[model samples]
Target: MERSWTQPVGVGVVTALVGFTSSFAVVLAGLQAVGADTAQAASGLAVLCVLQGAGTIWLSQRHRTPLTLAWSTPGAALLVAAAGLQIGWSAAVGAFVVTGALLAITGLWPWLGRTVARIPAPLAQAMLAGVLLTLCLQPITALTVSPLLVAPVIVVWLGLQRLAPRWSTPAAFLLALALIVGDAVLSGQGVTLLAPVVSLTVPTVTWTAVVGIAIPLYVVTMASQNVPGVAVMSAAGYAVPWRESLLLTGLGTMAGAGAGAHAVNLAAISAALPASAEAHPDPRRRWIASTTAGVTYLLLAPLAATLTALVAGAPPGVIESVAGLALLGTLAACLAAATADPGERLPAVAAFLVAASGVSALGIGAAFWALLAGLAVRTVLRPRDPRAAEKPRSGRHARV
Candidate 1:
């Protein structure tokens, strides 16, 4: 019993640590990109920490499964891509609310879930790849501008990628943190720590934001996070209560929206940590791992503001370098999936280029347009035979 408790608890702590540290920079960048000030961004991060922690605990215990919740990292990447859109903070918050509602509706309406599922894997992957491109390029751009400050971080990341792939991003982030602190102290600009506060904003809904931010955010979260989360748990031999999980995460997203959180959903890559055999030899006891992760997230919640403040004060591109480095693997995976099917390559490329272009028209962002272009190309080029279109393709399903 003691051994069981210790092993799962330890794995749970690692799950929370990796999940938080690995992507918090992207989360902060996304919030800031969408018009959040430092305080509001911190609020977003803190609320997300709390919500995912609480949601994970409830769902894991209620279902007796190693289910974990996470903030939508790909959705955050989409927001980072939307940086130049100039959507106001209130509008962003409103989009968050609408995304939550869409998630909940998907849970209740099977048809809606099926509709989102029908989105071509290649096109979905292409959009995600497109969204990730600009942010992933930041490290290269930063290295050109500040090689001395950025090179060591990339070196550490590369070393870890070969030695311990899972730890690469976290280690790179720690090194970047050290560099940021050292630079600040040496420059006589002391880091100011701030208490975490859940700063609430009155959400303002708009047609532009609804189409621009909310719709793409919803599609990304559903395709990338929620769907993959279920598959991960299933692969672990646990049947996730899909409706319950969706409702819980949807409500959590809404609850945090006023506090500036973009969205929260089922964990994808991080879910494997707590659900794996390494967490516990006995699958029945694995829920303990996820429960522990939830508690760990709560404990880490207060750090959001201090970390946000530190990154805010860091030299330009320093923190962005870390964010960019953290996302390289994801970008590579997306690109691979986007180009997997020869038949879909043209449409996928069309989507990828449109999304990467970051173009906006009539207040809608490129992600929306990218999907439109890909689908249009796909429709024109799709096979006439229904049976042929339904034929299974040989390869792994493309996931964000």
Candidate 2:
């Protein structure tokens, strides 16, 4: 499973692309959601994208697994709710610092890592299934909105998947882009490109943004993003250094604080795609994908403006759909995993429901809540079921 250089670059490009805007777009939306001025939001985004990409690239390589890194997407979605609140930039940076520090501390704590390691694999797998289900459903359902626009793309994607499995999505994406452009030219309706925003407002340190925004950012990114991101790596055959990864995330967030970014943590689903059978079947050579992505990121860090603007201009539905669709395979894998055995079925369903419910009672995300609830149910029901022992016996037959 040793990856060659070419493998990393190719996989990295695919990974880099998802970040190109999906990361920035939602962050910008978050800033607006919280009522930060255009400049402040953009600055924060700049810090976020750069640090996130760098963190991802670095760890993804070090782990030699399909370690995808991403800023907290749901965090942005959360921001949409917080928009119109008056939060100062300094406070926001402070929150980032706090979150980073917490991550570092937790990562270094062997107890926490060991506890996480104890979660049954099927339960962990179900968590992924829940997220991917929601993500993929978003895009597939898009066809109802514009079948003409979306159907052909999906049809081709399906055909390509069966006929040329590896190239399916990318090929479909390129083909869709070409057709969209061709229609624009032939119909004499060129798409309007917006000017890239390049605001540079300095953040004034404040306590409010820290308490209100920063803490939540840190909480969700680690609990939501980092947890599952690591799961994908482990599933793909990498023996990860949990503490080291935590240090990288902490450092990444620190870098963001200086640069005016939000949160940067491991990527879960999309990064897994390149690492999965979809991108490359060989393992040894896959680290190249993250390496390639890192190089692409370092080269483009300077062009943050152009990149953000382009994504900003693109239809919101497009990117959301893209993410949702890209996650379809992962979602299917998860769904099948959740109910593989009779004993874990109910608790796994609880995990899925809680995660999908999107409830955040104490600054933590539903994913965390789901796991907790499911675990509680499982613990309560464990002694009663002779079938429960079926799980422990599983490790003997665990896959590489």
Candidate 3:
């Protein structure tokens, strides 16, 4: 009763397409924001893809789990925000190395891992739910921008979700690809292929970049990406070695830093693609989907430049529609998980609102702030249920 390669392969292909199509442009923009020239940006993208691809392959196989890895998209956004803080891309690279080392150290230390585990599940889900809520609205927004292109994509997705839930994401993804490629063909652009150039720069450290860029990158990536990633995997009933996954991703991040890429970590949304019913019915066999995704990533490394160009030139609404459509299921699940605990509803709502507001305090992103606010609210305004706990009686104390 071995599962056929068909399911795993389909899931793998879906995961890769969604992963790359969703945020690869953001990554390129992040590099350019930080003063990376064309070659450096292309190299950074190539290195990141290769590292995550190889890392995903190794980790999923080693643990026999569906552990897909990805670059820190939130971290990329942070870099984009703090682009002017660093002198050059070299300084950013230094910060990247430091962030990776910090993650590696955290993995080696059981206390830190335990501390992360201690975070309330509701709060974690709230943060993820909040982040996804904004992005998941892209379909509606894209409709306003280009109804002809986006409306059909959403319709196709909804239809597939009702008729064949497992294939909805992949089908939507294939349709988006076709639409984009078809547009290119009609416009006579014809899917131009630009070879990726791999360039490495020696890292230069600056205290400003370390404090401003490194700390924020680490915080956001861990809170927004890795925490939700682990939550997604766990919810899917896959028991992964959190410490090991962090360590491998940390090493990969360091390896890619010199090539101008920032941190890499566990994926939140894309990981679900490989772990869902689409991958395989048997949980034990789902690892193949992640492994296949890794192979797909490796194959796409050389095409980073081309992919980057395609996305950059394509209609903005189209890209957003694809990403938003792919994340719809994950968004719904996160929302449900966040509100499942009635006792934690207030704090979770607070977290969700703050996270969705896209606020950044000082240098840190809203996700960290949301977590802090939620915990504070939960502690200060402890909602007491009369049936929950009882004080010891005076008579019992006397007897003791």
Ranking by TM-score: 1, 3, 2
Question: After TM-score superposition, what is the CA distance of residue 30 in candidate 1 from its true location, in Å?
Answer: 0.5
Cα lDDT of model 1 by residue, 236-308, tens digit: 9989888887888888788889899899999999999889999999999999999999999999999999999
Estimate the TM-score of every prediction.
Answer: 0.97, 0.65, 0.74
Which candidate number has the best TM-score? 1
lDDT tens string, model 3, 1-400?
A: 4456888987897788668765675577677767787778888899989999999999888988889999887677556556544458888889889889878877898776556656777777787667666657778888998788788788888998899875676677667767888888998889878988878888887776677677657766777688889899999998768788888888778888998779899988789988888798888889999999999999989987776666666776876676667666766776787787666778899988987776765645566667788889877755254333243332111110
Best by lDDT: 1
User: How much is 80 displaced in model 3, in angstroms?
Assistant: 8.5
Is candidate 2 or 3 superior in lDDT?
3
In Å, residue 78's CA in model 2 sits off its true spot by 9.0
Lowest lDDT block of 10, candidate 1: 391-400
- At residue 195, candidate 3 shows an lDDT of 80
